[model samples]
Target: MRYVISFIWAFMLTQMVNFVLNSLGGGSPYMFWSGVALAVIITATIAIFDVMLKHPDEENEAQHNH
Candidate 1:
C-alpha cells in the first residue's frame, strides 16, 4: 500500500543522503539514522497534508456554496 511505498522511498532517500555525505567527507555513524528520522518526519507530514487536503465531498460543497 501507500505506507509500504513510503517506507521504501524513505529508506532509499536515507541511503542516498548517507552516500552524499560520505562523498563530501561529512559522514558519521549516526548520519544514516538521522537521515531516516528526517525522512520519517517529512513523509508523515506529507501524508497528513494529503489526508487533510483530499476531501471528495469538498468539491460538492464548493459547488453548492457558490
Candidate 2:
C-alpha cells in the first residue's frame, strides 16, 4: 500500500516536472526531461522504500537477524 501510493506520487511528480519543463520555452520537450523524469521517479521510490524499511519487525524478523 505504501509503495503503491509512493509510485503514484512519483508518477504525478515526474509528469508535473515534465509538463513544467515543456511550458518553459526552448530545447527538445521530451528529450532530456524523459531521463530527468525517470531519475526523479527512481529517486523517489528509493527514498520512500527506505523509510518503509527502517523499522524491523521486532518479534519475527529480529529473531532471524544474523
State the displacement of the C-alpha of residue 1, model 1, in Å, after optimal TM-score superposition: 1.7
Q: Look at candidate 2 and give me any clashing residue pairs.
A: none
lDDT of all predictions, in order shown?
A: 0.77, 0.68
Q: Over 4 Å off in model 2, which ranges?
A: 27-66
What are the per-residue Cα lDDT tens digits for candidate 2 across 1-66? 766676667667777777677778564545555745685677676887786787756546767875
Taking every candidate in turn, the Cα RMSD to the unseen true structure, in Å, is 5.6, 5.1
Candidate 1 residue 26 Cα shift, in angstroms, is 4.5
Can you give the lDDT of residue 45 in candidate 2? Answer: 69
Q: Write the per-residue lDDT of candidate 1 for residues 1-66, one digit (tens) a residue.
A: 886688779878877877787778855454667778777887887789877897889878978999
lDDT, candidate 1, at 5: 88
Cα error, candidate 2, residue 7 (Å): 0.5
